[model samples]
Target: MLEKIFKWILTIVGFALGYAATEIAKNWGFINSIIGTSNIYRIGFISIAIILFGIIFYIVSPFIIKLIFKLTGFLESGIQKIPTNDIILSVLGLIIGLLIANLLITPFARFLAGNTILSIVGSTLTLVVNIVFATLGVNITLKKKDDLYNVFTFLRRFSKDKKSKADSKLGISQPKILDTSVIIDGRILDILKTGFLEGPIMIPSFVLEELRHIADSSDNLKRARGRRGLDILNLMQKELMLPIEVVERDFENIQEVDSKLLKLCQIYNGKIITNDFNLNKVAEVQGVPVLNINELANAVKPIVIPGEEMNIHIIKDGKEAGQGVAYLDDGTMIVVEGGRRHVGEVVDVVVTSVLQTAAGRMIFAKLKSAS
Candidate 1:
C-alpha cells in the first residue's frame, strides 16, 4: 500500500517536472516555432511529455522503493542508537543551518523571480547550500559537544556545595567505566561489595550489547561466559551497594571493545576498570588510568617470601623433570622441585622464590627436606 502511494507521488512529481520543462523550453525560440503559437499544440506537447515521464517514473518506482527502504532502515537504526542529547544537538544544528541558508538566499531569490529557469537554479542552489551547511553544523556541534559538556560540568562544580566539591576532589566527576573483560571476570562485583570503590560505576550500552551477542553465540563456553557477565551486571544493578549508572556511551568509529574503552576514558576523563592485561598496558600508554582487577588481586594476595614452607597437592608435573605443579587457593601456580613423583598427592614444599609478572604470581619451591 505504501509502495503504491510512493509510486503515485513519483508520477505526480514527474508531471510537475514535465510542465516545468515546458516553461523552460519556451525560452528557446526554436521550440516555440516547432510547437507553434497555438495553445492546442502547446498543450499536446506538454501532455505527451507528462505521460512519457509519468510512465518512466512508474516503471522505475520499484527500484527506487528498494533504495528508499534501505536508506530508511539505516537512518532509523542510526537515529535510534544515537543518544538523545546528540539528537537534540543535531536538530539544533539543522535549524541553524536552515537559518543561514535563508539569509544567504534572500538576495538570490529576488533575481530569480521573473525567470522559471533562474528560479529552478536558485532553488537547487538553496537546497545544496542547506545540505552543506546542515552537515557542517551537525559535525561541528557533535565534535564540540564534549567541550561544551566540560564547561557545564566545571560551572556545576562551582555552583554545587560541599558534596559536589568532595566528589570532584575524589577524581570521580566522571564515573569509572567498566570494560567487558572486568565485567566478565566477575571479581569487580566482589570488590565493589567491599565498599572501597566510591562514586557511580558506568556500564556502556555497547558493552552490554556485546555481552548479549556473546550470550547468543553457538559456542558453549562463550555463551556461558556471556550469560555470566550479564548476570553479574544484573546483580550489580539490583543488589550491589554502589551507585550504578548504566550509561549508553558509545563510539561508532571504534571497532574493538578495548579501543572503545580507551576512547571513552579519553572522553569522560575517567578511569577504566578492567582485568585485561593488554588493555591495561594500552591504557597506560594512552595516558588513561586503569584499575586492573588482576593487579589488585595480586596486590592483595598473601605475601610469601623465600624459604616459606606450605603444604600443596602435587596435581601435575611441571615442564622440567622431577618438578610438580601445585596451585594456591587463589590459583597462583607453585612449581615444586623433586616432587613430580608425588603427583595426585599432597606434599610439603618450601618457597624457594616468588616470581611476579603481569599475568599473576608464580612460585618455585623445593621439597622441605631438599631445601
Candidate 2:
C-alpha cells in the first residue's frame, strides 16, 4: 500500500514536471513552431512524454535502491574491522549535521531568491549542499573522535618501536581485547596504573559474564579472585578514566570461549591480552596477535647470565632432591642446585643457564663456592 502511494505521488510529480516542460518549450518556441504543431498534438505529445518518463523512472527505482544497498553493505563490511562504538558515534554526528543543515542552511539559501532557471537550480544546489555538509560533518567527526586511552597506548608502543628504525616510526594502532585470565589475575591493573597500556581496552560481554561466574563460584579462592578482578575493573574505569568498554559481541554457533576469543581477535585485527600460557601458544599457532602480560613482564626483567653470581634467598625446595627454588625481583623462577640447605637464607649462586619460554624466563644456577 505504501509503495502504491509512493508510485501515485511520483506519477503526479511527473505529470506536473512534463506539463511545465511543455509550457516552457512552447514559450521558448523550440519544437512546436518548427513542426507547425496544433494545440491537440502538443497536449498529446506532452502527456505521452510525461507518462513514459514517470513509468520508466518508477519502474527502475527499486533496482537503483537495491544497487545502493549492495554498495553500502560492501562499505560497512569493510569497516567492520573498526570499533563499533566509533561507527555509531559517527552516524550520530552525521544525523546532527543533516538536521542543522536542513533547519539553517536550506532556509538561508531560499532567502536569496532568483529568476526561473536560477531559482530552480539554486534550490537544487541547496539540497545538494545540505547532503554534502551532512556527509562531511559526519566523516570529520568520526575521523577525529580519538579515544584518549587508545591514543596514549599507541604512543607508548610507538616510542618503543622507534628504536628499530626511522622509516618504521609509527602507524595505526590495533585494538586491545582483554581476556578473562588477565582480568582475573589483576596484573592489568598495575599495567594500567603505569599509564603505559594504550588503546581502548575492550572487555567482551562474554568475558564479563565469565568473570561474574567466577565471582559466584563455589570455590572460595576463585570467588575472591573474581571479586578482585571486578574491583580492578571499576578502579580502571572510575579512577584511571581508562575507556573500558564492554561490547556485546559474540560468535554465534561457537561454544568454546577460547575459540570465540581467537575468532574475535582475528575479526577486529586486535591483540589479545591474557596471562594464559596455553592461550598464548594457541594464538601463536593461529597467527593471531597477542599481548601477553607474562611476556611483557619478562621483557622488562633484569638480564641474568650464566656464570654471573647473584644473591637470592631460597624460598622453597624444588621437586628434585638438594634443589631449592628462588625468584628474581620480577618473579622469574630460578632453580638452585645443592641449595636446599640454604632455604630461609640468602645465598650467592652462579647462574648456569637461562630458559626463555612463552610463560616466562627460568634461570638455573649452582651455589657459589663458599669463601
Candidate 3:
C-alpha cells in the first residue's frame, strides 16, 4: 500500500513539472504564435503534457524506488563504520560552516539586484561555497577533534568558580588504559571487581573498534574470543562498581592498535593494563608504566623449593623419554622425570628445581623415591 502511494506521489510530481514546462514553452514567441492564444487549445495542450509525463513517471517509478533503497542501504552501512562521536563532530562542523557561508553571501546577494542572470549566478555561487566550506569543515574537525576537546576542557577548568561534582568524581591521577588483549583475556573484569585497581578504567575508542572487528571476523575462535571480550566489557560496565570511561580520543595517524595505546598512555600520563607480552615490553622501553596481568598471575602463584613434594595427576608425556608432564592449580608446568609410564595415574614427585622465564615458571621433579 505504501509503495502504491509513493508511485502516485511521483506521478503527481511529474504532472506538476510537465505543467510548469508547458507554461515556459508558451512564453516563447514561436510557440505562442503557433498556439494562437486560445484558452481551450492551451488547456488541451497542458492536459496532454501532464498525461504524457504521468505515464512516463509511473513506468520508471519502480526503478527509482529500487535505486533509492540501494543507496540508503549503502549509506547506512557506510555510516555504521564511523564512530558515533566522529559523526556528531562532523555534523556540527558542517552546520557551523554553512552558517558562516550564509553570513558571507547575504551581503553580496543585494549587489545582483534586478539582474536575473547575475542573481542566478550569485545563488549558484552561494550554494557551491556552502558545500565546499561545509566539506572542508567536516574534514578539519574530524582531524583536530582531540586537540579541540583538550583546549575546551582546559579553558572550562579555569573559567569555573569551583570544582563541579563531575570533576571531583575523577581521580587526581591518570586512569589505567585497557588494551584489546587484556579485555579479551577477561581477567581484568575480575581484577576491577576486586577493588584492587584504582581510578577510572579507560577504554580507548580504537580498542573497542578492534574488538568489534574481531567479533565480526571469519575465524570461529577469533570471533568467539572477541564476542567474549565484548560481553566481559558489558559486564564490567553494568555490574561492577568501578568507573569505566570509553575515551573518544584516538590517534588517527597510528595504524597499530598497540602503538596507538602506547601513545594514548603517554598523552594521558596513564598506565596500560594488558597481558600482551610484546606490548608490555614496548611500554617498558617507552618509559610507560604497564600492569601486566600475566606478571600478576605469576607473582601470585605458589612458591616451590627444591625437595618439595606434591602429588599431581600425570596428564601427558614430555619431550624426553620417560618424562611426564602435569600442571599446578595455577597453571605452572611441572616436568616429572621417569614418570611417563605412570601417565593417567597420580604420583608424588619431589621438586628438583624451579625455572622462571619470561613466558612463565616451570618446575622439574622426579618420583619421590628417586629423589
Candidate 4:
C-alpha cells in the first residue's frame, strides 16, 4: 500500500520535472523550430515528455526513496550536532545574502536583452552571485552567532521583564539559580525568610528533573531527600514574597547536569545556589558565580576566637588519645584536648585555636578545669 503511494508521488515529481525541462528547452532555437506556432504539437510533445518521465521515475522510485532516506538521516545527524542558535543565525545570514544578491543582479538582468548565449551567461552569473552571497551570509552569521545571540538575549531580557523571564534589570540583581543539591539541603528556605539574599530565584528544569528522580529513587534515604526538596520548593512558591521563577531553558547537547547548570548560569547571568562542595569549586574554577549554602551556614554560625570559654557536652573520643569531640548548637565540631575522660558529660572549655576549613568551622579547646 505504501509502495504504491510512494511510486505515484515520485511519478508526479517526475511530471513536474518534465514540464520544467520543456520550459528550458523552449528557450533554445532547436525547440522553437520543432514546435513552431503549433499548439496541437506542443500539447502532444509535453504530454509525451510527461508520460515518458513519469514511467521512468515510477520504475526508479524505490532508489529515489532510499536516497531520500539516506540524505535525511545524514542531515539529521549533522543538524543534531549544531546548536539551535547556530541554525537560526545561518538562516538569518542566508536571507540577508539573498537580498544583497538580488540587488546586485538587477543591472545585469536588464542588460542581457535577447542574445541566448549572453543571457545564459548572465543567468549563470546571477546564480553564482546568489550562491556566493548565500554562502557568505551563512558563514558570517555563524561566525558572529555569539554576539548576535547576546544582543537578542539582551533585548529579550527587557522585552520580557514582567514575563516569566529573569528579573536581571539595570538595578536588579542577577537571578539566583537553585540546584538540586541545595534544594534537597533545605536551609535555603530559612535564608529566604531572613531576606538577606536577593530576589528572583530561578529553578532550572533540569535541576527539577534531577530532584524528581531523587524523589522517585528506590533507596529510602534518597527518596526522602528528594521528597524533602520538593516540599521545600512547594513551600517557597506558596510563602515566599518573590515568586519563584522556574526556568525551562536547557542545553540539549550537554549530558552532565552540572555542566548544563554552569552553562545556564553563563547564559542567563545568574548565580548558582548549591551546598555541594564539589560543584561550588567547579563553578569557581569556571568563573561561574555560585552561592554556596554551606558557606552561608558556616558564615552565620557564632564566631568564637581563641581563649573564649564555652560549655559543650563531650559526645565521643577524638583521633588523639584523651581528646574529646563535642558539637556546638550550630553543628561546629569542638575538639577538647585531654577531656576524653569527661565524655557523656557537659563541661566548660576554653578555646585554644579556631580553624576554618572547607568542610566547615572546627575549634580546638581544652577543658576549663585543665586550663
Per-residue CA lDDT of model 4 for 1-371, tens digit only, reads: 87678889999999998888788878899888999879998898888888888889998999988888789899999997888777888998999999999999968977984688888888999999999999999999988876885676567555554643434444667789998888998889999998988868999999999999999999999999999999999999998997689998777868999988987887777789998888999988766778888878888999898989998999999999999999988899999999899999999999999899978899999988986
Candidate 1 — which pairs collide? none
Query: Which candidate number maximizes TM-score?
Result: 4
- List TM-scores for all candidates, in order: 0.57, 0.52, 0.55, 0.66
The lDDT, on a scale of 0 to 1, for candidate 1 is: 0.85
Q: Flag the better candidate by lDDT, 1 or 2.
A: 1
lDDT (Cα) of model 3: 0.87
Candidate 2 C-alpha lDDT tens digits along 233-299: 8877887656677888975546878888987876666789998888999988766778888778888
Ranking by TM-score: 4, 1, 3, 2
The global C-alpha lDDT for each of the candidates, from Candidate 1 onward, is 0.85, 0.79, 0.87, 0.87
Candidate 1 TM-score, C-alpha based? 0.57
Ranking by lDDT: 4, 3, 1, 2
Q: For model 3, how does the per-residue alpha-carbon lDDT over 257-341 read when each residue is reduced to its tens digit?
A: 9988977786676789999989989888766789999999989889999988999999999999899999988799999999899
Error of 2 at 191 (Å): 1.8
Give candidate 1 misplaced runs (Cα > 4 Å). 1-174
- Output candidate 2 Cα RMSD: 15.1
What residue runs in model 3 are displaced by over 4 Å at the alpha carbon? 1-171
Model 2: ten consecutive residues of lowest lDDT: 160-169
